[model samples]
Target chain A: MARTLINLPKTAKAGAVIEIKTLISHPMETGYRPGPEGRLVPRDIITEFVCRFEGEEVFRAELFPATSANPYLTFTTLAERSGTFTFTWTGDNGFSQTESAALTVT
Target chain B: MRRALLGLLLLAVPAAAEIAPGERRSGFDQMTPELRAMQTDEAANPGQLWVGDGEEAWAAAPPTGRPACAGCHGAVATMRGVAARYPAWDEAAARPVDLQGRINLCRTRHQGADPLPFESRPLLALTAAVAAQSRGLPVAPPADPRLDPARAEGERLFTRRTGQLDLACAQCHDALWGRRLGASTIPQGHPNGYPLYRLEWQDLGSLQRRLRNCLTGMRAEPYPFGAPEYLALELHLMRRAQGLAIEAPAVRP
Candidate 1:
């Protein structure tokens, strides 16, 4: 399970590109860090992220071990109409999270 | 340029009898350039989320009959430079009060609203909002004579070793400053970037939270939140950080 935050403008002009910011809390363990007993911490991180607006794909990204903890992603998409924007993240250890926010284009 | 020359002069003219010089550099100065850049970019700093929430909270009236903070204060911009002068001596209370205490005082006395718990999200948000208003202002606690006793007590507490590890705040933050403690460098331990978003915490937190973490690391029992000891320590820390720019809602690793 992951804690997520999604930021989207409450309203935007029709056809205007609006910025969307999302942050997910994940350790993004690189597997290189040493644990208390000198053992390597297991690697875990969100590997894929996808965003959809009005059921249509808008943005996508592939994350890696090099990604920092609490991965933050910001992107812009054209606001076509008043609708919901959905975000999904999948990663190691069978981790997955989904969150959505509503936006209105006046 | 003149400030740099003054700094050099101060360094050259050291006096054993003079009071210890305050830290000139901020913890932000020790950060990697990329991390520094993130803090500089308001859009990128995660702390801004709480600040945004704080802005809303300032305008929202609770169940109490009193008006919202915005109703009285008008614009948040007017609050600029206010946080930098906190831990001020409250004559009515006859003691020093930090920003958090001041907020709670307003809530109970003026708004008739119950005081928010320390470290609570609502409290942190409001504190962050007030602190955000003072961003970039120099930390300048009032020069009230009554605070001297508490300042001295705080200074003693800072140097007096305690806890299972027998460590004091000065041990790592002062004597070992600029040295590496594992992957992180020991900072001068100023209170400038309070209510900052520490990546280690993965959320916005108060200075008290950080201090508690330190005490825990030392195997020391932490004082309950809002304890007078913490306020005294805060007053001392603020004085130590005098002239340092406030970077509230700052980001850190």
Candidate 2:
């Protein structure tokens, strides 16, 4: 499986804002480059990345070939309730990966 | 006459030309300071993702397998010196095999499981993980008289001109080492930090993937995965990387 990494605060106060970071290993092949035979390399890149906090959508991104490989994203979200934060990355070539982390609001 | 003379000169030089100890350096030495900074930091380096996954895979049996790798290997720490000694002669296969190939062999033969596809994420992850244990250890491929032929074949492949570009691996990597190839610096073509993270690739990949990329860059035909040529090339490259510290799960641009 493509490796995914996430950073989340272990503890946060209710109603306080928290930062989240995510990175995944992927080639994000742009399809523009030529192969050994001068044929165009097929374009394959992460097309969408979404993050949900406590089952509510908090951050999302539409990725493209221009996006760097191993897409890294940082965003802020409110620690409304102690719950699960689920992140999903969808891309070309049937590539889809999901990761989750727990946040405790004290 | 000139072409023959050039060939003669090339033949006079050993393909496995040794760099003096004082002068030998890994490709990482040629990177810009900023990239070096990123590669050196575990938190910033993306190769950690695969390393992490590799940690997970080590403990868990494949979906169908009865034995996990940890069943016999004990602790991951025991594997520290293991990766540095691979691309060794596999008596059963009667050929040289790298860490990845060895892992697949164990999976299929010992684990009673299907082998992961070459360049697949699971394979790359596991390879990175195994290699990570050897981080900072010097590479020391075992010396065996039986492997001499494979090593020689690898040297020939390294020095042979290929593709429309008609370039040999020695030209850009050896002759142009530390020089600029457009925006990027040419590396000495070491195989230490394989299953490495390439910013251009945006994903972790095997040494074979990188080799294929180079072939594409040269506008040359790439051999199929698991081909003897790649194994031979890997054998040759690992020797070239001798004495360099293992830095698997390394980051590259």
Candidate 3:
């Protein structure tokens, strides 16, 4: 399983906008770097990230080779009700991981 | 008579120039506000990835089925303040062993596993994880008589000039710290933070790696990883950094 860190308030007021931050461990190796034999290191990068609240999509991003190693992302989402936030990252070589955190709207 | 007195005063200058213990500053203090923020925020610090990996490794059993580190050491939290006393003297080796050395020793002797290569992800992850447990504790090198000789040798290495640049660690870190070195300010070169995430490398790394980088930058042949000289130097550094808080997994530019 990919190591990930997610930051969000455990509770938020209804209609309030809350910030969410995430970081995941991945080399995100761009194909440009050379190896010991001076051959290009093959490209490996996370291509997509999506977050859903109560099973409805809230935020999404399409990543590229330019993204750094251990990709970190921060965004804001509206809190409408108490639910779980599920985060998914899909990448090259069939690498995909899904993790979730719960939030309460009161 | 005046000339003789002036010569004596000149002889005293270098000794007096060493930074006083009360004045010592951590690399953390020298960082840009953004980098400091990055180090403080767990969610944003890239080093946390390694710590997370380490937490897993602590409990994982190798294919050989030997006990995991946690089996003997208990919870990782129990390791609090342990890193502060590293580069401690080892009776079995009759030499000093830094935190990484101790970890590798455990794998080989206790777990019956091959030692992980230096700079490898597994090694960095585990070292960072272990050091993170001591994050807020003051570095307290054990008062072991056996460590005295190694610490002395380390002090010599720190002050001795070599390499194409003909510089000693003290020339910059001790005498000229807080001064500008090209585009960056020279830091005091304390080891309070090890296994930190340097933005320039875009990866987590150990203190030995950082020291080697400095050696190479001076146009000197860096000793191979796990060299005794490096361990001696680490012992001295921890002693020199006494009372400084550990900041392993710190972020740096």
TM for chain B in all models? Answer: 0.90, 0.92, 0.93
Give Cα distance to truth, residue A60, candidate 3, Å: 1.9
Worst-scoring 10-residue span by lDDT in model 2 chain B: B14-23
Across A1-106, the per-residue lDDT of candidate 3 in tens digits comes to 7789999999999999999999998989888999999999999999999999878999999999988888999999998899999999999999999999999999
Candidate whose DockQ is highest: 3
Task: Summarize candidate 1's per-residue lDDT along B1-253 as a digit string, tens digits.
Answer: 9999999888767322222565367889999999998788766787777787788889998787689998889877788988998888887889888888888988988899999998888898889999998988999988999998988788777877989999998888767888999899988888998899898877788888998998898899998888887887888888888899999999889
The predictions' CA RMSDs to the true structure, in order, are: 7.3, 6.7, 3.6
Best by TM-score: 3
Q: Report the lDDT tens digits of candidate 2 across residue range A19-64.
A: 8878887877889989999999999899999998777899999998
* Candidate 1 residue lDDT tens string, A30-98: 889899999999998889999998789999999998887778899999988999988999999898888
Query: Which portions of model 3 miss their true places by more than 4 Å?
Result: B1-15
- Give the range of the ten consecutive residues with the poorest summed lDDT in model 3 chain B: B11-20
Q: Tell me what fraction of the real C-alpha contacts between chains A and B each candidate also makes.
A: 0.04, 0.58, 0.96
Higher-lDDT candidate of 1 and 2: 2
Tell me the deviation in Å of residue A48 in model 1. Answer: 8.2
Model 1, position A62: C-alpha lDDT score: 97
